[model samples]
Target: MAADPGPTHPPQHPVLVVGGPTASGKSGLALALADRADGVVINADSMQVYADLRVITARPSPADEAAAPHALYGIVPASMRMSAARWRQRALAEIDAAHAAGRLPIVVGGTGLYLRSLMQGLSDIPDIPADVRQAAMDLQAAIGSPALHARLASIDPVTAARLHPTDSQRLIRAWEVMQATGRPISAWQADPPRDVPAHLSFTTLVVEPPRAVLYARCDRRFLAMLEQGAEQEVAALLGQKLDPALPAMKALGVPEIAALIEGRMDRATATATAQQLTRNYAKRQMTWFRNQMPAALRLDAMELASGTAFTKFYDRIMADMTKNITKMG
Candidate 1:
């Protein structure tokens, strides 16, 4: 009989990042891994950070959260926007706290920017003046995102070319930066990044299932959320009458459900529309993770969801973490 080997352990604690498209079972994987590794699950999803729309956002349920330590989920109000830099600050503190308690830090979510900020750091872009910010928003609302992109091309062609014409948020940001400072936003981005600490090493896993399977999961999950009081969640959020541009207000399913409540859309139409949007968002997430995270260990979503496969995967991850650790001493 072969001799049994002891549990694999790294010389130093390593942060595990579980990134994937929505409805990809990242939360379940993270929860199970947290329990096995004595880790803390930290939220990296931008939508999941908002306190409102918990049901609509498909945040981990209370029962699941009770099974292990979780942090940075549903902490920020929907009325406020969270920048990548701000989230990095909060997430780093959480990681430090988790390390101090002798637990692994598992950062889980599909937010590429958030994960990137943690691993690669962020550029030092100066804050845009309030008036300048408002002007950019007003212009975007007045002319629509595509038209605004054209206007941006006239001034900052380099930055404008990189952003999708329909990417209203980023388009507005680039325009705002150009207007606030004489230099383009790309110039600011080229400056050396700050605030990244050198002590931590990371093992990242990205779940990318077959597209057909992922789309079906996305559709099913949105419908499940509706049955689980997502409509009520959206209605309550709309009752606050927050700015439409707010990230939470624009979260998936919010607009469709809000239209349903307002009588502008029928129930079936709203459900179908939201499901399609969710699938589209999932596709974008898959593309971003596949193209950006070259070094991540890719797993099939179905495997991550399976009990036997997940156990084997966890062992592989432990080996990877131990092998990939960067010496700090």
Candidate 2:
């Protein structure tokens, strides 16, 4: 018999992550996988980590969370800072443990960078000093976002071009780095970690619906949230006094949600604003994934409503992954 050609390089790591816009049924999908008790669910969403404002953030319900072997959600207090580096570290650790036990690590969330850091590595930046942090925050409070972006422009024009004037976190971080270390913020971002070739073989799926459909969905979903005690959740979140700059607070509908809660905007206004913001964000996500993940296994998924829909989705994904893994092996 003729000798069979063996595979050359081994495949990358094995991790299944489900990503989509808010209310896109990611959590339910993770939970369904866990129903078999053959998998562990870890959060990749940035907002779900904050413990204080769980309900408003649309975090996994306690029942769903209990139904699965969940990790990395509702652990961090809103007062503390959690970065992509930190989340990646935690996810890798959980992924390694789950794989060792022969369980699938069903990672799901909406945050793009958290997934990026897991697949690509993150820059190993040391923590900023408290004084430096306070100084930057104070400057932000004193001057304004425009002033902060101007300073970033002066320090690192390349970075400034990519950042918006109102991007509070990026603007403040750039200014903080420039002032504290006397170097451009962009300098520190030069050596972010690249591949996780040795850790696991994996497949990535990006859920991209058409712009009009996603916008309509976003509108319906936000209105539904209001009917389902979203106001109550917002009231709870208000008690946290979390920094407005926290990534959670910047979720698509969050500002408008907050506005409605605080009486600055009515429900109608909040609904309209949320729909617009979400639509814009969905388009941005689609663009990023389309351009950056052309090689990814793109799955054309509509609104994933029930836990079952997610199960079928991943069954398809894992089957494809297994085929590739076997070929590579």
Candidate 3:
């Protein structure tokens, strides 16, 4: 048997990013690759960061974590709001640490914004003041998403055109930026990002499953989550009464499950509603990954779903790594 590389022989290009829609086997693929390559798995999904919703968010199980080193999963408290910037900073540190220890850094998740911030870099817009942010949030709450979107369009048409009318988060962000800095968010974005190191190299893989198969998996997964203590998880979170506007509170199954727990809806209705929402969210994720990561290698999720297909995929990656190491030598 070939000896495990351990911490001795680092690859020339040391990062791999696996991204896909929810329930598309991204975590499985990342773990398989990590096992083969002696890599460290880092979280890139926004929802998986919260310490509260591990089961509901489908974060890697304890067995998977023991199989390889995993970072950033379930590290933050549910009460704290984790922004993309904070995640990016922590991820960069994890990537650097992995490389220093001669392990491949495997970043995997479904969150497009998080991945984009890591890969393409992010705008260096100054932080919005608390008052500005609060005002934007208050206005949105009072007038609703459509009205807030209309207001954003009046001040920043470019940013407004890119966002959906119901996209409360981005709408509030744009409004806050405009209110804080007296410049549109789009204008600030046109300026170059402040800190992207030129030395980093990334190998990206995007898994897009067939829609019918993916949707079915989404539905089945939610049912499985319920069986696997998701209701209790939400019940605990709700017991804390964290701000409803917090991102953790808005995870895919969270609101529906909360409604069910609060007696506002029955189990059957809540399950169906959560399943539908998961499918819709998955559709949006699929579209975002397709459009934003154009240069990434695209594979069907089914290609990595089975042991045989995954073995083939793993072998290909290893072969490529060997060739690259040879070329470097």
Most accurate candidate by lDDT = 1
Preferred candidate (lDDT higher): 1 or 2: 1
- Runs in model 2 with CA error above 4 Å? 1-13, 29-37, 192-197, 247-252, 303-316, 323-329
Error of 3 at 104 (Å): 0.6
lDDT of each: 0.88, 0.73, 0.87
Evaluated against the true structure, the overall lDDT of model 2 is 0.73
Best by TM-score: 1
Model 3 misplacement above 4 A: 1-13, 305-308, 318-329
Tens digits of per-residue lDDT for model 1 on 196-314? 66667888999788889988998999889988999889988998989887888889899899999999999999999999988888888888898889789987756656678878888
Question: What would the per-residue lDDT of candidate 3 be over residues 182-298, giving only the tens digit for each residue?
Answer: 999999888887676444667678888889999999999999999999999999999998877678988989989999999999999999999998998898888888888887778
In candidate 1, clashing pairs total 0
Quantify how close model 1 is to the true structure by its C-alpha RMSD in Å. 6.1
| TM-score on alpha carbons, each prediction | 0.92, 0.82, 0.89
| CA shift of 21, model 2, Å | 3.1
Model 1 gets an lDDT of: 0.88
